[model samples]
Target: AQSVAQPEDQVNVAEGNPLTVKCTYSVSGNPYLFWYVQYPNRGLQFLLKYITGDNLVKGSYGFEAEFNKSQTSFHLKKPSALVSDSALYFCAVRITGGFKTIFGAGTRLFVKA
Candidate 1:
């Protein structure tokens, strides 16, 4: 079985500071990883994905993530946080042969100005 855990329910940070949203996963075989952001009443927007190759993958809005295969972790990172960055984030994973994707409960990012 494949699953994702987002330990933090929320992350608070001031604008211009670095921010991180932690994520860990358990899955069978290799996994396809993804990060998505959601605004109020809006569908999730794709932030980044880790299919293969690079361990460090960059995506929209100056966000990036590091895929640690050994630790079964993929943590999202940003050097500078923005007040507009305040939103909900979800970490998701899918097994190689699975059609269904599992998502973490979600982490609410609150960036203060």
Candidate 2:
């Protein structure tokens, strides 16, 4: 079984500050991690993915995440937070050889302007 955990229910950041949303996972095999963002009532949007490559992966909208195998963590980061960046974020783990993808409950980011 594969699962992801986003410890924080909400992360608050002021405009122009750096923000980080933490996540950890448990999987049978190598983990395929992904980050997604959802605005208000919109659908989930793919932000970044950690497939098979460097530990550090960059994604859309100046977002990036580092895959830590030892720690079983993939934390999302943004150098400069924007008011528009405020959204509901999720961390997901793709079952190595299965069709199921488990996602964390979600973390709401509030970027105060």
Alpha-carbon error at 74 in model 1, in Å? 0.5
Root-mean-square deviation per candidate: 0.6, 0.7
Residue range 1-113, candidate 1, lDDT tens digits: 78899999999999999999999999988999999999999999999999999999999999999999999999999999999999999999999878889999999999999
Tens-place lDDT digits, model 2, residues 22-74:
99999999878999999988999999999987999999999999999989999
Clashing pairs for predicted structure model 1, backbone only: none
Off by over 4 Å in 1: none
Best by TM-score: 1
Model 1 residue 21 CA deviation in Å: 0.3
Give lDDT for model 1: 0.97
List the candidates' TM-scores in order.
0.98, 0.97
